[model samples]
Target: MAYKSLLCVLTDSDFLEAPLAQGMALAESQDAHLDVLTLGVDRSQNGYFYAGADALMMQEMLARARSESDDIEAKCRQLLQNSELRWACDSGVAQIADLGRHVAMRARFADLVVLPKPYGPNHGTELEPTIEAALFEGQAPVLMVPEDAKPITAPETICIGWNESAEALASTRAALPFLKAAKTVHVVVIDPPVHGPNRSDPGGLLSQFLSRHGVRVEVDVISKTQPRVSDCLLRHATDKSADMIVMGAYGHSRFREAILGGATRSMLENATMPVLMAH
Candidate 1:
């Protein structure tokens, strides 16, 4: 009752290379399909993200873009050749690139997506157009990768941010495959309300659910006064040496989710490990 395939969408950017490798390894471990998709967002395209730029900006951007694209393809091909998996790349049609919109379009068919976090330089934010599109427009589970994601340990452990919400339940169900692979699993819920005598049930039905599936589950109860679940979860992950994070994504809508106003957004922006989220 778990996913049998994973789509690893790429756009020839260096930022995604290592994360793609990590995603591929994850897919292989799960016995899933690894589909590599590319959208060469052409700087020359009149309506593309690069179209409204200056002349010099366009030139260097395209050069780096092509170089990154070439590197992504060659590396992916090499990795696929040596591994026992089905992997391939999609390089868009002709010279046109969909950039963020393209990636967003293909996101519909993927069980989960993995991409690199953007960094701003000299006051310029790395929140490139594509990242924005995927986070907001792409209606799929996406895993954002930090800079140093290569040594991401599989056998260590992972944490799931839990709450009584649809998104949370979806995230938990989708994360079963990964949780089953971890050496340890923690289903962390923070700061439950002070109970009256009528509240007979404890706050760990989710933990019991995973336990039924054979996951090594641990429950944590923290301060309700802190008012920052994201900070609490991140600290917990660090303390427990969690390699990946599993949490339900609650948002009013997809477009508004990327701004990441709540603890979930904070966790995603500040996550040291790969985050698995489903809308």
Candidate 2:
């Protein structure tokens, strides 16, 4: 019901401040231990180019990676030095292809993983693999913070995107602590099917369930007037002045979402506020 251990994933990028600040703030607020993992990834090397001088090229790349990792670790320590929260900093070097598994190994021990938003102007595809690993391989809920996001000690108003899928259920369960602590919680259902389990009531069942858990909850059934369901959810959250949005991730296959665009991908790319997601 509460997060006792937190993991913050970082890379050797300029987008480190947001996730670090968010992680520390959450740890201070929840009275939890914080672990920081910085991954050093060098994308300048190609296997085809190192035909003759493989060993020397590999050695040089590793040395550069180690220096970057050390610098990142030093920066993390400097920022966390004065904080009273229990914390630790660690770093590793991994090839881009192996980054996901590397992060997943450490992510398995944490209650919740905090990560950088993988898509946006401030970020590239470097952290996308890591996020997928933390959610799917590690089987942990991930709180993604945008590069410009402000540190949230505790969210006051939260919006839950309800779809009655197993993934949504998992995310809602993972977000129970935040929902119970929030001043307001909105269960937003976007154009529910008239022939399904929620035919009689769109978001009523979920709202009732949350109310029993001491959540100040309400149901909002909105018509899908927008082009995408994510747009509707984001608009509703913004209207409600939500500090964070809680939703399931990748209800469809990752490859499908990547190629055809799904709600999860849209939310990840467009959400202005922090997003808590589980898969």
TM-score of each: 0.76, 0.95
lDDT per residue (tens digit) for residues 1-279 in model 1: 555556665654556666677777767666677788654445556446545668886666667666656766776776677877877676653234456667678677776677666442321132345554554577677676776776342546988877666777787787777787678887776765557331243346877788888888887665654566888888888989888888776545534655646765576568778887765
What is the overall TM-score of model 1 with all chains considered together?
0.76
State residue 73's C-alpha deviation in candidate 2, in Å: 1.1
Best by TM-score: 2
Runs in model 1 deviating more than 4 A are 42-71, 93-100, 118-138, 151-154, 194-202, 224-227, 250-260
Candidate 2 error regions (>4 Å): 44-53
lDDT (10s digit) by residue, model 2, range 144-236: 998889998668999999999988988999888889999999999888898897688887888889999999988888999899999999999
Give, for candidate 2, the lowest lDDT window spanning 10 residues.
Answer: 42-51
Report residue 7 deviation for candidate 1 (angstroms). Answer: 1.6
